[model samples]
Target chain A: MITAEQKPIDEIRNMIAPYKRILALGCGSCVAECAAGGEKETAMLASALRMAAKINGEEVIIEEKTIDRQCVNEFVIPLDDIMEKYDAVLSLGCGAGVQAVADMFPEVPVIPALNTEFMGETKDQGYWVESCIGCGDCMLYYFGGVCPLTRCAKHLLNGPCGGSMDGRCEVDPDVPCAWQLIIDRLSRFGALDRLEKIYPPKDWSKKEGCGPRKIVREDQQK
Target chain B: MNNVSRLKKVLENGEFAVTAECGPPRGADPESVVKKAKLLKNNVDSVNVTDNQTAIVRMSSLAACALIQGMGLDSVLQMVVRDRNRIALQSDILGASALGIRNLLCLSGDHQSFGNQGQAKGVFDLDSIQFVRVAKNMRDEKVILGGDPLSSPPDMFIGATANPFADPIQFRAVRLAKKIEAGADFIQTQCIYNLDRFETWLNMLRERGLTEKTFILGGVTPLKSPGMAKYMNNKVAGIDVPEELIKRMEGVPKDKQRKEGINICVETILRLKEMPGVKGVHIMAIEWEEAVGEIVERSGLLPRPSFD
Candidate 1:
């Protein structure tokens, strides 16, 4: 799922500095599961902003609202009528959520409240870890189902980079090296010989090209 | 840009080239950097100016390399992929080379969470492998990425880091081959205290003839105390310190621990020089720069070569 962490209140305050009337919008899906954004998050943020404004003697009003999923246009359409009343919107969702709101309401400035972290699963109650790079091409089946593209710091295709030690990544000793986990799982599965075959350099063109990606369905389309 | 070719020349000359690391300070002051460089000016073949080594913010390696060059020391500027994107990386390569800094060490730096600025975002657009390929192409091919011709290309002796101690140890030498395939001319390895495992890594390199492809500089850092040995063994990633070595350090008296540290480093240096495929030693004295000259001298690498 898409994950993010809330931006510090001071930075969020600076982002919406130009607008006095703003919408503290949230998305119910993905981000809500991560507790980054949801109806509860939106209400809490609205209350905090109100308190901050009161303490600073600033004239500001934040109206909270949440949609099913801000990445879709249908969920963002609900903001059309209310958006006219506010000068700007503060999206308490992932980056996709902010963009979706902006794509719908081109005139009102849409501010991001969280820094979209990565596509990962919930490790513990509040902790999360990245697991996928969304590289468009999936090669997880080959590397014992571990996504080196996302988990490995270098995204090395051949094997682990020279930074991993004791099954931990060199970048941060806390995180498990993706390649290590792959090697272990593959070794246990008696497929260690499969690791000798080196995959070629990933073609980034398929992943993050110059523009947005699209999957057309000719048969399903009118 | 004209390449400052002293380090390359030394390695090609086949007379064991010795390189040492001088970390750029955290502040803007260059006085200490100049002093440190001057201290090792007559002792080592080349000095590697680190790019925010250990993920901590420091004076930019490029600026520090320029400063080291001004002191008449060959400067190998370390470039990590943690901070800059491809555009900024290529631009800095041009800027550094134009300033007469030649040797470039490509690295995927330690993560930002380890440093004082944990809140900073890391921008690793290209990993060290891809970064090495990009740098070599820019220098040798005389063209920027995407086939754009450059007005003038920067001449550089491309280098990369290696970790003989990283897990999946069987693949370490093979990874070095990949780096060589990416056009790495020289490799400065992670710190070495365990000789048997290092020998195993070298055996793989020798079997594949990768030893002949690039000059391998085994990294060595003197143990200041048993605590340091324990910390490196337990805390530092890609570093494996053997228990016997730590026991040896622990056997020493409290005041003599520093002496034992130098002795162990000297011994490691001797063994590294005798080992096959090992070209030299990269002495990382950390902030204890004063001990570098002594370690080099005791290791019988004194009276550095002077090429007219």
Candidate 2:
């Protein structure tokens, strides 16, 4: 899941100050799951912006709209006819979704209303935690599903880092030690020997080292 | 010799080594590096040059290490994985070696949050243990990361850091062993203040015979003042300043607190020298290089042993 939070209302107001009429586009996927850029969030944001502008004596029109998934081309095609009616688009989506909308409508300005955090899961009610780095090479099988790359403060392949006290990281007492979790999980499965073997340096070329990563599967291509 | 580092020679010859740190200036100016190097000249065996230390922007550590060599001193080029990819790190290793750099210290680097440039993106493409393995490969196999052979390998003595005070303290030795297995020639630890804990960690290292596989340099810094002691205790990660030591500093007068700090550092050096598997001391002195000479003299690590 991609986690995000709404930007301060003031910042959003500033972004739409010059535009008299705007579209508050919500992403019904990841951002919606996180309650950041869903249909409900877009309507509330649009209403709040209209009230704020009216109170400030600014004639601004905000229209609420949501697509199934802003990152998909098919989901974004519906806005093509009405994109020109708004001065700009206030996208309540992740970075990918915002860029997707921008890619579809080259002339309309797409402003992000939420900051895309990371690929994570909702840990509690209204709380989310990052769990993966999307490194292209998945090693979760080795660590019993614990991700040192995403959870360790130092991203140490060989860790616990002398900073793992009471199963928490030194960077923050609130954060659990990723390695500690791995160790416990491995122990439960009686695979402690796996950690004894030294892991080589991460092959970054296969990961994020070369640059922005892409997975092109020729076999899956039409 | 596989490495030309004087510190390596001292350790191999069974002599106590003294390595000091020199942080590059924030700007391109080499004035501060040069001054610090001169102050530490002959007082220590080799100097450890830090890279973008604390995540702050500074003169490149490669340039600073080269400058230290120009000062007629051996420099342990400290490279962090936080900012460089394999291409840049490997390239720097080759260049640093070509520039006559013999010692290298691999680190994952301090988090960018600890530095002035919090917005800077950290490139932890490889962790410290991985960095050590690559450095070793570059030197022994005479190859780049992808197994392409090099004309001549860098005669580099690879080193990494250990923080005994970090949580799961018992795992520190295992982590150290992993680094050594990954091909670290030496290990310099985070600053040491808790002697009892350090002793236990050393015992763990020795029990596993990790002490014999790689040279271990204990890190020590003078506490400076009560405030600094408290800050290190409460703020700094991977560092543990025992309450007794902090109380010792607070026991002294404000003007004399600096001396108390030096006294504590000297005490640490003496104990570390006697401890099993301890090869030497790496005095950080963090911006207090002038006191290094005095600390070395007081700690009786002076008249540095020469294998030359």
User: Best-fitting candidate, measured by TM-score?
Assistant: 2
Q: Write the per-residue lDDT of candidate 2 for residues B172-216, one digit (tens) a residue.
A: 777888899999989999899988888888888889999999998
Write down the RMSD of all candidates, one decimal each.
4.7, 2.8
TM-scores, one per candidate: 0.80, 0.91
Query: Cα RMSD (Å) between model 2 and the true structure?
Result: 2.8
Q: For candidate 1, lDDT tens digit of each residue in A1-222?
A: 999888999999999988999999998999898998888888998899999999999999889999999998988887787778999999997998999899999999999999999999998999999898888899988889998878876666665776677788877778898988998898889986776554544677787786888889999877
Q: For model 1, which pairs clash?
A: none
Which segments of candidate 1 are over 4 A away from where they belong?
A: A3-70, A74-118, A122-128, A136-144, A154-159, A171-174, A184-222, B1-4
Docking quality band of candidate 2, CAPRI definitions = medium
lDDT of 2 by residue, A1-222 (tens): 999999999998888888988999998999999999999999999999999988999887889999999999999998988888898999999999999999999999999999899999988989999999787789998888999999998887877665566687776789998998988898899887778767776876676556777779999988
Number of backbone-clashing residue pairs for each candidate, in the order shown = 0, 6
- What is the Å distance of residue B180 in model 1 from its true position? 1.5
* CA lDDT of every candidate: 0.87, 0.88
